[model samples]
Target chain A: MPPRIQIISILICVFLVAYVFELVRRRHLSEEYSMGWLVTGTSMLILSVSDRALELVSELVGATLFTSTLFFFGLLFLMVICLHFSIRISALTKQVRTLTQHVGILDHEKRNLEKKMHQAPWQTSDSSLEQI
Target chain B: MVTPEDDRAESVSYPEPLPQAPKTLIIIPAYNEGKNIGAVLDGIQKHFPEIPILVINDGSSDNTETIAQQHNAEVISLPCNSGYGVALQTGFLYAVKNNYSLVVQMDSDGQHDPANIAVLLEEAQKDDCDVVIGSRFIGKAHYKTSFARHAGMLLFGTIASIICRQKVTDPTSGFQVLKSRAIELIASDEYPPDYPDADFIILMNRNGFKIKEVSVTMHASPDKESMHHGHKTVYYVFKMFLSIFVTLLRKSPKR
Candidate 1:
């Protein structure tokens, strides 16, 4: 790989790591989800800076060019991160659904209690709402 | 037209009615159904004045909640637009929480006639049936549907029929009645979150619940498409298959 491209790659990795850290500091990104990105950024920085590491990765990946090997690993990292996000999103969707239901139920229960307060115990018809 | 009054069992003739306490609760899950909710509530109210009606409003942008409230029906408005299954599970949760002995869940659309509530109740009263499904394809319902939907319904109905060893014609029918045990089970984690159609019926059957399908007539939905339309139809089919397979894979939560 040309020194120019390696310099650019190193700068990008530094920027990625700095941006992720900034996001965590500002609370835009939580540490739980940022771990993958941080690790990927750090690994990319190391791969770019160290020629020995870059050569070994290129030979292991059977890539003629060092840059292609870097690109392959970068792409692989992105795919893994995307899959992780997808899994998190699905879990969050279920959680949100359950939360929404509980909110609706609680609201209804509050209203029922208020309505019951106004009515005499004998007059209220839906008195069995609590036994279950 | 079989009206709710026709063969509507009175409280006195309930075949061992529970001490006049409100045992039966009708749960209506509605989403953007302001147009027909009033009439639906009125029809149910007219026939069964004693039974309490609760409507689970799925965060409709329309005046569905207000209309349901105006009809003197208990309304549980979800905070946001949720699926029909979520709205339904909410109703089941409410029923289970309230200790209602019997729960009749029907569609919010005008398609399901309030008159058929009695039909379901009668079926449950006759035997130890935990779930009474009001089948549209049975007998002389004459309910019309799109070709794709009809095919899907037939496919699942056939699957359910074979498994349950009963003639399950309407696996997708939303108009049905559930006893407390059935209601509690559906509301639990065992129930699928999205479209709870054929898989749920089969799940109940596998769990040792007696499911009875009674012939009931339903009107064709006018100016309204099914909830499983467009992209949702594909997802519904895929989810239906996956959930059915999953239901079979999992062990019974309750005997």
Candidate 2:
């Protein structure tokens, strides 16, 4: 709305975009997930630099106040980001569950084999003989 | 009418004889059931002495693993709590790997009566079903529960019955006997990770697995608060509805 606020918003958007790119470059974040942050940061930068475009978007969204329109879009962007994180979390949860199950079974089998070996070292040789 | 045993005998009298006794493994999934697991394991051992028992201790803060091992049940300790579904699936994987022909899943909370395991085993041995569920609602057994939980079970049972195209009386019952076919099928990645209740039954049915229910007695859970309590109950209802709805919309899973 004001010139000073617009300048601060542009600065923040620039920093956000740079940080997201840095993360991608470092391979800390995958390109698939970084796309949302990149779009949000670039959109904010564009809207902040162009007052006419902001006013037009506010009118299109039927908001009487420009700040309210910006807040609305910000909230909408946040909702989308939250939804994306939730989907990723769901996939990770499934993967973690599968891994945990396998690990538990394997650990159990290893302990059993160790105990059997301790009890009867000769039994192991019988199995090896059978294999031969 | 010829009895099932007599029919089996008559069939065996022919060229090909009946298959040998199926190797059965009892799997008990325990989570924070340290207080009750010992007695449950003892009961199973007393009644089914020859059958091997395996307990999947689901990363309980208590001494569930110790108690299970002390009772002579093979303990598979999960590194962390991964919920009931994952623990049970771990047991399924173990059964498949060990080449067990039948797997009997019983809770470590002492709710499921070990005496009724024979009923489930007999029903499973009929050779007509891939899975046999031990149901509490079908028999003279009286299992008391909170009104909300009972209502939830009824709701899910109705929905699962409609989707499964069969009468599902106790869709929430966890005590079951799975043949090798069902065991192999569930060991796959399609098994639900959380509450594997009515939605799972529908999935198995859609996958062409024959499911049969036998009446069984059960004791009330020792814990005052169920795993599905106040707010958790609401989330459970929402999650189950979403899961069942999505499952219905998806293409039928291959056998």
- Per-residue lDDT tens digits for candidate 1, residues B75-109, read 99999988888999999988888899889988888
Alpha carbon RMSD to native, model 1: 5.1
Best by lDDT: 1
Please provide, for model 2 over B139-168, each residue's C-alpha lDDT reduced to its tens digit, 9 standing for 90 to 100.
Answer: 566678889888999999999998888999
Taken over the whole model, the C-alpha lDDT of each candidate is 0.85, 0.84
Per-prediction TM-score, please? Answer: 0.87, 0.85
Q: What is the lDDT, from 0 to 100, of the residue A3 in candidate 1?
A: 97
lDDT of 2 by residue, A23-75 (tens): 99999999998999999999888888899989999889999887677678777
RMSD of each: 5.1, 5.9
Return the lDDT, model 2, position B227.
45
